[model samples]
Target: MKKMMITALSVVMAFSLAACGTKSAPDSAAPQTGGATPAPDKKEVTLKVGATAAPHAEILNSIKAKLKEQGVNLEVKEFTDYVQPNVQVFEKQLDANFFQHTPYLEQFNKDKSMNLVTVTGVHIEPFGGYSQKIKKIDELKDGATVAIPSDPSNGGRALALLEKNNLIKLKEGVGVKGTVRDVLENKKNLKFKELEAAMLPRTLGEVDLALINTNYALEAKLVPTKDALFIESNDSPYVNILVSRPDNKDSEAMQKLAKALTSEDVKKFIDEKYKGAVVPAFK
Candidate 1:
């Protein structure tokens, strides 16, 4: 009987040591569940936002700590392509996205049934022509090929910009989703080679000129102010925008984030960092 008791106690002691040695939940994660529903568990909210690498992601990174103070956590995921962010937000994978603009968003919703909506206007990255072949706008040849983004809205933006600088001409009121097909007159007869927005900078060396998006240009280390043959007006309606799901349009999380984006600190960051390539649209 004494031998039996000693064996049982030894087994218990071994189990206790095994339990102590094995990994378990950290003490900080311990539940404080009492009778009263645990005070809502402090509501640890997380927001996942998608954006382009440079200015959009960089801009969000700058304000992430500020957001953490308000009981919010931010995850800024970067994408090289434009289409996925809107699709991700539509599929409810992302909380929000900050890229593209009002017109593009409208066209995307109409075409893809994504139902995406803009929450706030961010900065406009002026579309412009960059070229290793031509030092000035006047050097564009009659049939020289220039690369442009393939997406309809941005293509129109690039076309409009080229026209603005006397590089081409278009029908009146082509708006943001305009393309080369909308051009009523091409005074220069510039042959446009449409490529992905991310690929335009790579085409700069091969083509006489390329109409590059600001974000893509920024990605390729091409600054619009210093490298472009010509640029679009920053005041153009085709500015980049911050977007969210249509259902979440009025959510408090979005409101807090939008307010934070338009704060003076963000405005100052845009003005100082991007120079004139990016401009605060909040004011």
Candidate 2:
């Protein structure tokens, strides 16, 4: 009976110890505190984007601090000409670019056989006709020299603006696709000078008149609302976009940028800073 009692006591102790071990194991393994699990640290990412000097770069600069707070470092590279931005982006030298409109981008993609895509439409820089010598469109003399962008899309845009004001008439239905050859009627016998878009503002005094992009006009200290002889309507179809490759278009960082570019803050900045020269495309 004594041996049986000792054996029973030993068995009871073993079970108690086993139970204790099991209880403590879970206690050490899992936190019993009612706190939520901590989130993993956000990995900071760097995004390199290219843009023109005025509104594009300026607008991009406006959101740099905001993006940094969101764990993205935005590097804005300013390009003087339109071609390099697209070239660099295509070659993977830049993650994206922010200076061209939809027509321009589509034409560029078609012409170069590139597959660049738009991430978001940010704003519109109204195409305008400006001249240092003429205060009014009627003041343009016969045989006056008019400057327009050399690129096909912008050249067509300039021609459309002139045609709207009855400065010239395009071949029927040619619309914004018309070139110098498509001029059905030249009332003033105006000579068309096909210069680069960037050079149009500089040729304001040299050419009898020049059609300039608002961004370039702003860079040359000309306000589109005040200085332009004729400007595109607010509902202009050419909304500038954030262009990127297909591979990175849907990336977390790129989406964040697209969101930032279309945010209310950007709209406010565009309204307050540009007055009417640069209009935000977003609602």
lDDT by residue (1-283, candidate 1, tens digit) is: 9999999999999999888766465565566677355445567478899999978999999989998888679899999998999999999999999978887888889889777888888788877888898787887778999888888888887887777787667877875557777888787778889999888888877899888888888989988899887887767777678899879878877788888899999999999999999888877
lDDT of 2 by residue, 1-283 (tens): 9999999999999999999999889757897546677779989999999999998999999999999999999999999999999999999999999999999998999999899999999998889999989899999999999999999999999999999999999999999999999998998999999998998888987999999988899999998999898899999999999999999999999999999999999999999999989999989
- Number of the top TM-score candidate: 2
Each model's lDDT: 0.84, 0.94
TM-score of 2: 0.87
- Residue-pair clashes per candidate, as listed? 1, 0
TM-score of each: 0.83, 0.87
RMSD of each: 7.7, 7.0
Give the top-scoring candidate (lDDT). 2
